[model samples]
Target: MTTASPADELALLTRLRRDLHRIPELDFDLPETLRYVCGELEALCDDVTARYGKDACTVFSPCKSSLCMFFDRKSEHATAVRSDMDALPVTEKSGAEYASCHQGHMHACGHDGHMAMVLGLAHHLAESFDELPRSVLLVFQPAEETTGGARFICESGVFERYGVDRIFGFHLWPDLAMGEVASRPGPLLAATSESTFDFHGKATHIAKAADGADSLEAGMRFVLDAYGYMAEQAKAEPCLLKFGLLQSGQARNVISSHTHIEGSLRTYSDTMTVTAKQHLAELAESRAAEAGCTCTVHFSEGYPPVVNDEALFDLARAALPDLHELPEPLLIGEDFAFYQRHLPGVFLLLGTGTGIPLHADTFDFDERILAAGLETYKKLVRIP
Candidate 1:
C-alpha cells in the first residue's frame, strides 16, 4: 500500500483549486456553480442529471479531454461523495489574483478546495472507472453554510435514485498540521442547532418604569445567568454557549418592551445536545414569566452528528497520519452528516496546516493537502 504519493497529487490538485477558486457561489440556486460541476463530470459519468431545485432541468454530457477515460456503468455499486458548493456572506481581503468578484461573498471555509479535490477525483475516476470495482456519485451540494441543503437533497432522493451503497467525505482543518487526517470512528462531528429567544414586555416611560416590567433588564439577567448555567451543566465534552448578537432598548426614556437573542448550542452526544437545548428553553420561559413578559424561542435544526463506519475507515487506515491523536467526538456540525445518514461513510478532517478558524474572513488553509485529498479519493474509488 503506497499510502499516497505527494508530487503527482499536488500538481493536479493545484490546477483543480485554481479552477474552483475562480468561481465562488453562494447558497442554493447557483446556476454557474452547477454548470461547472456538470461540465467537469461529463466525461467521467455514464449519465448526468441536474435539477435546479426549481422547474428547470438539464442533461449533462462529456467534452473531449486527452486524459484516458474509465467508467463502466455495468458495475453494480454506487456511493455519494459530497463537497459543499456555497460561499459564506463574507468579503475577500486576500488580494490574490483570483479574489472573489462577487462582493461580500467568499469561500472562507475551504469549501473551494473541497470542490476542487472532489471534482479532481471525478475527472480522474471517470477516466479510470473501468479500473474501479464500483461507481461513485459526485454531490456538489449548495447551502451547507445555512445547513439546509443536505436535508433538501436527502429529501430529494439523490442517494436512492443512484443506489449508493456507501458514502465518504472530508473537511478542511487548519488546527492540524498539513496533510494529517483527523477522524474518530463513532463520532467525528457533533449535532448542533441555533436558538433564538425573544422577550417582550410593556413599554413605559422610565420615570414610570414601574408601570412596565423591564424586559431588557430581564433579558440581560437571563443571558448572564444562562451562560453560567450552561457552562456548569453541559455534558463533559466539547460544548459552546455564546450569543453573537443582542440588541434591546429603543430609547433611554422608554422601557424596552422587547429583546431578541441569536446564538447556537453544541454538544458531542445526541442526548447532551437535546438536554442542553431544553435547559436553555426552560430558563428563557421562566425568566420571561417572572418579569411579566412573554418569551418565544425559535430553533434552527442544523446538521446532525457524524459517525464514521469503523469497517470502511479500516480499509483506508494506513493512509492517515498520527491516527492515534484524533480527538474525541467533536462538537462541530457538518451537512456531510446527511450523506452518512443514508450509508456507511466517514467525514474526516484533512490537514491544512495551522491558521485562523474556519468561517472567519482571515481563514486560510494549506493548499498542499489538496494532493493528499485527490489521491486519497482516487485510491478509495479504485479499491474493491
Candidate 2:
C-alpha cells in the first residue's frame, strides 16, 4: 500500500466532508449516513462492524446506527478515537456548494468534519498497519445531539472485548483561531441536567383575583429564588442555572391554572448538581405552597462533565505543537464524557475561527482546517 501525501490527504478529507455534509441525518435514524460511513471504513479498515437496532443490547436498543472499526496488529492494547455521527435539525443556510441536500437537516455541529478526520486516519493507518506501535479502534457514534450515544457504546462491551486502554475525541470550536487545538486537564466541559417544574393552581376571572390561586406567581418566585441560589453557589464553584421557557395563563382575563418551567442546570461535580437540584426543588415547593398551589419537579440525569485524565492530557500537550492549554472549563456538555468514565480519555477542541457558533443554520468552516484535525488524530494515535 502507498501512503498518501499531505495534499492528497487534504483532498480526500474535503471530498468526504462534503459528501457527508450533503446527507445530514439525525439522531440514530441515520440510514444514508451510516451506509456512507460504513462503506468508507470497510474499504480501509481490517475489520468493520456495523451495529444497528437491537443488536448492541443496550438501553438505546432502538438506535439504528453506530460503527466500530478495528486494526489488529496483535498488540495487547488499543488506542481508540471517536467521532459523533448525528447532525442538528436546523435547515441549511450556509449557501455552500456542498451544503445539505436534505431539506430540513444540516451538519451544523461539524460532525461532517469530525467524520472526515477519523476516516482520513483510517486511510492512513491502512497504508502503514504494520508500522503502528499498537492496535487502534475507530468509533462512529450516533444520537450524540439527542440521547447520549456514547453511553450505549460503552455498555456494549466493545472496549473491554477489544482491550482498549485509552480513547480520544475532538470537537470543532469557533472561538479560537483556525487550526489551533485547545483543551484543559480536568473538567473541560460541564455536566448537564434538564429540569422541569410544573405548578398547579385554580383559575378564575381577573375581576375576582382572590378567588383563584396564582400558579404564575409561584413559578416566577421559584425562578428568582433559584437564580439567587445559583449565584451564591457560583462563588465557591462554577455552576449555571437558567430557564429558557416559562409558560402560564391561557387568556388575558383569566388566571392561569397551570404554569410550566423548563430549563437546565450545569455543574462540574455530581455533588454540586445534587445540592443545586435540592435547593431548586425546595424553592419551588415552598413558593407554590405560599401561593396556595401545588408543584412537581423533574430532573433528567444528563451527560457527566468531560473530565480529562491529567496524565493523558500531559502526554497530548507534549506531543502536539499547536495544542493550547485552557485556563478554565467551558459550560457546554458533551456525550464524550461517558467514555472517560470507563477508561482514560481526552476530549480536544479544534479551532474553526468561522465566528459561526455551532448548531446555527449558518454555521460553516473552511474545509482546509479539517487537515489540521486529521494531523492531530494522526499524532495522537502514534503517541508513545
Give Cα distance to truth, residue 205, candidate 1, Å. Answer: 4.3
The 10-residue segment of model 2 with minimum total lDDT is 51-60
> Where does candidate 1 stray beyond 4 Å?
1-9, 45-76, 205-208, 236-238, 318-325
lDDT of 1: 0.71
Worst 10 residues of 1 by lDDT: 61-70
Question: How much is the lDDT of residue 300 in candidate 1?
Answer: 78
| Winning model by TM-score | 2
Largest lDDT belongs to which candidate?
A: 2
lDDT of all predictions: 0.71, 0.88
TM-score of 2: 0.93
Name the runs in model 2 displaced over 4 angstroms. 46-64
Number of clashes in model 1?
A: 4
